[model samples]
Target: MGKVTAQTRLANQLLLEAIKNPKNLPVLSLADWELLIRMGRRTRLLGRLEADLSRIGLLAEIPSRAADHLRAARNVIDHRNTLVKWEINRILWALNGTEAPIILLKGAAYVQANLPPAHGRIFADVDLLRPEERIEEIEEKLSLRGWLKMQIDPYDDRYYRVWMHEIPPLRHRERGTEIDIHHRILPRTSRLNSDPALLFEAARPLEDSRLHVLAPADMVLHALVHLFLECDPREGLRLRDLLDVHLLFQHYGQEQSFWDGLTPRAYKLGLERPLFYGLRFALRFFDTPIPQTVRSEIKNAGPRWPMLWLMDHLVALAILPGHPDYPYPWATLARHLLYLRAHWLKMPPLMLARHLLYKAYLRSRGVRGKVDLAKLDLRQQ
Candidate 1:
């Protein structure tokens, strides 16, 4: 990581303090509030910050400018929430005749379930998990109704169909909303084995709707996998995503059953590692209220001290939001390393090397293939 300046350190501390303890925000001067707002906006946590403050009955206590920005973010989230609901309705309408079960994933699921993570969160598209065998049928049904495949390169399309967990995202021709259909959580070639069947079995249906969402424990597990495995650190550690996990834990951790089932469920689905990393970081950043016994149980799932020590440094640099005025060279390096680590975890050594070489060859020849799609949009994912 690049050399850290005192100002940058203060910026990081201020933002973390704002999120983790909004009750103390009233003591910050106007200048610090401005910096805090900028950091929150950059990290995509302004809405979450707003929600946190409102939950604690301290929204009106912050500086007026900061409050305005937070409220504005909440307004954007409200509009997107409505669009997501409509998109979900359209999807169900398009697939009206199908017998396949549809389960909502991620942000859309959080919204429909009235879960804590949905508060002040944005949604870019709908993600649905369905039976693997029925994928083509569902694809065809949606195609007939106007949702069409995103016009990505044919090679990338084949790669997704053959190796990836989800197909290339589909965009509606008229409405321009996107949808990602998945058969499983991780890619087919991933080392970890999180079965779609198990997710389906544990899913709970939404009230007065045909749709379902992963059970509370499963939902948290899925969020962990998505955060630790699927995300590209190059874009930013997506602190907002980590905050989602924090909020989910804070909401669901109230029940003894939720805590009892979480670790066992992770072990059953081969997601224990993600659980370990998720819990570790969530506690570090937000002091998420995980039980002491649960923490001890998850310790066995982590790497040895040497590797864990290295990962602690890498994740700290890569996951934390950087100051807008001063970017760190070391943080960029950490992000690149973690980016490769993400790809390595997704595919075995030989396949990953081949994939990287092929993508590199395309880059050398000025061929823009799937690499373009790899560029992340924080608002979207």
Candidate 2:
């Protein structure tokens, strides 16, 4: 890993400590505040700092210019939460007309569960997990209600329908709100067999809502699975993800069975490596509460040997913020390698080869891997 700079260390220290315990933070100089806010903003976490500092009466002590950004972040977050609720209502109402189970995943799940991580989170949009049997019916229902599927090249569309875990994203006709309809957490082609029934059986519903969210243990496991799969290095997937795991641990990790249950649960789902990394980083970054037995079992569960060394260095370099003036070239390399690893692990060799060939064909024709919605002129629903 690259040498940690003063900016990176200070930012990590502040953000890490804020996650560990947000109350009674020490006052900082202007330079410190600048680095802290910038890193927080990049990770979509400035709002957490704002809310925490305000809760402890330290918000007034920061530089007014810095405070302005935090205030604005909090406002943006509040608005985002409202948008999430409206989108949730719209989705549930659309699916309410059907007999299938309506379940929220990730950010939406966190919000429905009332987990602390939901606060100050930048929700992209809602993720809905429905019965695989009902996917066509649900897609048809949403289509009739004006939710249009993304129009991509035929090859990529077939890839999603045939091998992916989720369907092509559905965007609202009037509101422009986007959602992913998922049948499982991992792609169908992945070696891991994450039975959607395991999740559906464990889902708990929100008060007076037709929607259900993952149970506490299931929620944590889903976060772990998503974290390892989505850790892109080129466009860095920030530490906000690890923070989600840590925050969820803070709330639910205290349960005596939570840590013990996570191990067997992930094993059953064929996701020991992702769970291992989640616990490892949560411990390293925030000293998250994990049982020693669980720790011992997972220590050897992650990517092994040379790959392990590579990941340790690369993950740290890529995930941590560096001094703007002295960016490390190796961090970029680490991200590229890990990004490839993520894709490689998602599918077997032959299918991956075909998938790449198809995607390459699309790119040659100017089609992006995941279609860019802005290019399609999306708007808020």
Candidate 3:
């Protein structure tokens, strides 16, 4: 492991210890408290910290400034929850006549299912998945209901319609919340496009509505795939993503069936690699409890010797916080490698080359260097 800053240390300590045992928050110096707050904000863990601290009455002991941050984060989360309910209701109303099931994904699923991870989690969009054939009708209905499609160039539009997993993001003109409509769990161009029907078959409906969430095992797989293998690799480094994995383990791992089914389900999805990496880091970082037998099985199922060794080293650098210890030269290089690795895993070389070239061309033509997830209020995984 690389040397990490005291700030990262304090922040991580708070997260791990508090999640495991909320009553046992470590005592903090003023400087440590400041760093904890800063790191929490950067890693999207402030709301989580606030929730855990309050769970055991330690929220009051935090420094005033830190408490202020916690309060602000909680306020944002509460507001987001309110907006989420409104959005869900609107979605139900829009698709009322259709029999297509509106399956919520990611943060939306966490919130809808009342999962432990959703307690203080935030979301910028509501992700909806229906069977592939229903997508066009759903999009048309949403459009009729005042959700406008995000404007993109013709090429990018075609990229999404033909190649990507989801439709162009749609934002409600009145409510201003983006909703991603997906017909599949992953991009059509991705290397591992498992039969989406498998996922659909495992979904169970939420109470009193058409909204559905993936089964416990599928939910874990989705989170693992999202964090470790899909979307932005930098996002996997976020403490909140790690914490989500921890919470999933804490909540669902209590069921012996959850453990028994995990491996087989992951293989069925063609996602054993992501699950392996997810479990590896979740255990390493948070000491997530896994049955010894299951752990042994996963170890036996994991990547081969040198590949595992390389992933351990590279992942440690890529996922750990970058800063005073692991500076830009080294830490940033790890991020670059992992970022490209995500792209390589998603698309074939020829397609990836063309995509990167076109993106570079756009950057040269004064398009932003990259879309800032934070600025866009994106809550990926």
Model number with the top TM-score: 1
Candidate 2: tens digits of C-alpha lDDT, residues 137-206: 9898888777888877677788888989899898876677888999999998787677878889888878
CA lDDT of each prediction against the hidden true structure: 0.86, 0.78, 0.77
lDDT by residue (1-381, candidate 3, tens digit) is 334444445445654564566555446667766665666666677788889888778888867787889889999998998888789899889878998688899898888888998987888789988888988899999888878777567778888899888888987766778899988877888887677898888899899568889888888878876776553544434557777888998999888999999888988888777888888888898888888876766666687889789778767666655433234345566667777877888789999999989988987899753243334532321
Q: lDDT at 331 for candidate 1?
A: 78
What TM-score would you give candidate 3 relative to the actual structure?
0.90
TM-score of each: 0.94, 0.91, 0.90
| lDDT of the structure predicted as candidate 3 | 0.77
What is the full ranking by TM-score, best candidate first? 1, 2, 3
Q: All predictions: root-mean-square deviation over Cα?
A: 4.1, 3.0, 4.5
Q: Which model is ahead, 1 or 2, in terms of TM-score?
A: 1
TM-score for candidate 2 = 0.91
Off by over 4 Å in 3: 1-26, 231-236, 323-328, 368-381
- Which segments of model 1 are wrong by more than 4 Å? 1-3, 370-381
lDDT string, candidate 1, 147-221, tens digits: 776666687898899999999888776677889999999999999977879998989999845899999989999
Worst 10 residues of 1 by lDDT: 372-381
